[model samples]
Target: MAAKLEGGAYLSSFVDAVLEKLSPILEDDDFVLEENDSALELLGRLERSLYDVGSVLDDAELKQFSDKKVKKWLVDLQDALYKADDLLDELSTKAATATQRDPDQLQHKSLRELYVEACDSLKLLPLGDFPNLKKLMISKCQSMECVVVPQALPSLQYLSISECPSLVSLPALTLTVPQLEELHICDCPEINCFAEEFLPPSLKTLEVTKCQKLASWITSKGLQSEGLTHLWLGPCFDVKSFPREGCLPASLQALKLSNFPNLETLDCKGLHHLTSLKSLAITDCEKLENITEEHLLPSIEHIYIGEDCPLRWKLARRDGRPMV
Candidate 1:
């Protein structure tokens, strides 16, 4: 007997239902359990964690809209759970087919089959099927080049892509995702440009790392959002300076820049326009010798610069000096 609660269905019970349906098949003599012991152990751990997660989801559902942070946390949690479920399904299918056979022949067959399956899974990402998708993350897909967004995604709030070295660009993906709120791109070196209109007005946070050729955000009328609250750019060596034209978002509240060896200076005029900025961090820019704060706003409260930075004295505010 199951309790009839008046809210979202519990995920733990869903997993239990799956296990109940699959129990008889797993007990069959054709399904050798010993051959799939490792996968089953992992599946057990995932199931237990998901059971704990269901409580968190239930709690969040009751108070999500009242708190912005809670809503964001729920989105992230749901995205992670969705990915875990996909991987669990794949592992379950693999386990169901595991069987004992001659040692030498079984070893060779398993290796070839696993390699083919891994390759196929890495190349296919069917995001277009979800009409109300929010928060998508595609990681470790080495052979992926293009991610196609076929339809409008008004509900999408976050997107993250990482470790896809062969990916050249996001083609026609951002056009349909106008409501995206956060984006993170990491370890994708071959990417060159984030074209105009790539970032929408609804975006609040953007983080990029180790993208070698991505010179600057304002290169060609791109990344000119006024609603951005946080921006992080790191390990992008080719970008020698912040855009000289003062194109950064005026509504930005936090900014972080790191590991740009070629970066020489940041245009003070642009930095001055960030009236809402509360935190600014710059690190590991070896060649950054000339930084000006002539027009910097007084709203900035926290400032962090590397030891090599020449503008450290300008950031200090303990001696009754104004942060002008």
Candidate 2:
């Protein structure tokens, strides 16, 4: 008899709590039910039913001690209330989901610059057409593997991607972003090569660092961009030699190679055609010992060689060479 009274009291409190939760939900003006009129009607009916049951709760609790059938009825009413609450929760969740998936809620069309960082579960970005987007930067996204670029980004100028270890390759960007001027990629180890045959012709600056597989591919296939002027490749331990023959374009004016621990040779044949090349920097190359020919640097007006390199001592001994 004591246990029955305790259960009755718990049910009375539970009914009050459910009614309290339902009241605000039914009265909330901002709670949208746009296409779910039936769900709205159902919620209204459920709210009324809760109110009716709440009025009888106190009477039912008192009578439950005397009548076993009244106790069973209260227990059955509690079970029905549980089902109603679950339905209300499901309806609210669906409404919230619908609001979130609405495109007008995000307003992505007018967005100019987008930066995504540290999203551990993000696997792919299916980028849509953003006509006015100028710069895109992505970093530290551990699970991000691909970015789907379906169409052209006519006004895009700069793009940078870094620290995404799972990324395998870039989308075909050669013809997609015609006005792109600068691209910087760093610390992404899984990317072996560009997805396209060549980078955009309008690209003027390109920087790649710490990506060994990509560095190896660049060394073998050569960096092939006609208008590229400033280039930096470095700290890529796997690269043993600078530009293979015809690897660099004649339009290149400034180049920097640093921290290549395995770099041993500089092929003069690769440097001979770089008539526009003016500034050169080589630093922290511990194993670099050979420069195939010294005269090939005729156009170079400034040179920076790090102290740790044996090439620094060699360049220091050479006479009539431009060194800075």
Candidate 3:
């Protein structure tokens, strides 16, 4: 496929502009924003993720690189950013319109139907008995100390939590939100470990970041989910080693690990059990010392390692091709 001609800097600029407009509204105290509104909370997370992408693109300058993978990633990011920009525009209009509405009518506005943001704590009943709710997102609520899943959200298919520094634990997924298909938790520094029954068989995608305590847990007991296809764990400094094969599910197709600064060794013999694995990525693991063909699975088609990785040059392909 031909690469797009647009520059990455342009996309970075667009994201910066979007953040500029959205940040003020998020901080506006005059809007009488409800602390527990789920929809607005989801939007706040979307904004925060966009902001994070903007920061990454600004520093990456992907337009200068001729690599096909980098170009493709940039193109995909541009497409997503355009959609996010439009959504933010609509949200801004709603916030403005809601501000103009009379108090009585506003109380009954449908905008109140979404998830909440910036709550001091996630009590058990944020969305009490939300039987029909399909998605719930919580983000940037720094004071949120715990998450207690509501019992009636059997229909929930997606759940995400980000930037809640004080959040320490999450309820077991098997006990709550059994239908959840995607789960993402990011930048929650205080979370130490997931509940033992954390991986509900219905989940397909899982992503976790910047949770040192959780990273440590993974080292001793890797996640196993027969239904999961994608897994990402990164930026957790406490993870000193990788999990053995018995701890991982055979259904995982793509696995990515990043910035585990203390990681020193990986048991490749243990990784051979992931028969369905297609892609493996190890980036910014500075202490990782060696990676040989024995440590890789024949099923892996794409392997990406950062230049800073100690064993980048040692990683090879089963088919005699370069392993990047």
Clashing pairs in 2: none
TM-score of 3: 0.62
Question: Residue 66 in model 1: shift from native, Å?
Answer: 71
Most TM-score-accurate candidate: 2
Candidate 1 local lDDT, 1-324, one digit each (tens): 112222346544554555553454345434434456775566566656666766676776667668777667666655655566555445444442233344343232323112112222344343333435566676676776766655566677878887888778775545777888998888888777775554688889988887766635333343677689998887766666664554778889998888877888777767877878889888888777665545455787877778776554544433344322
Q: What TM-score does candidate 2 get on C-alpha atoms?
A: 0.68
TM-score of each model, in listed order: 0.59, 0.68, 0.62
Instruction: Give per-residue CA lDDT, model 3, range 5-31, as digits (tens).
Output: 255657767778777867876776544
Instruction: State the displacement of the C-alpha of residue 122, model 3, in Å, after optimal TM-score superposition.
Output: 6.5
On a 0 to 100 scale, what is the lDDT of residue 42 in model 2? 82
When sorted by TM-score, best at the front, the candidate numbers are 2, 3, 1
User: Which runs in model 2 stand beyond 4 Å of their true positions?
Assistant: 1-107, 320-322
- Candidate 1 achieves a global lDDT of 0.62
The number of the candidate with the highest lDDT is: 2
Choose 1 or 3, whichever is better by TM-score: 3
Q: List the residue pairs that clash in candidate 1.
A: none
Instruction: Please provide, for model 2 over 92-125, each residue's C-alpha lDDT reduced to its tens digit, 9 standing for 90 to 100.
Output: 4333323233445434455588776665666775
Candidate 3's error at 242, in angstroms? 1.6
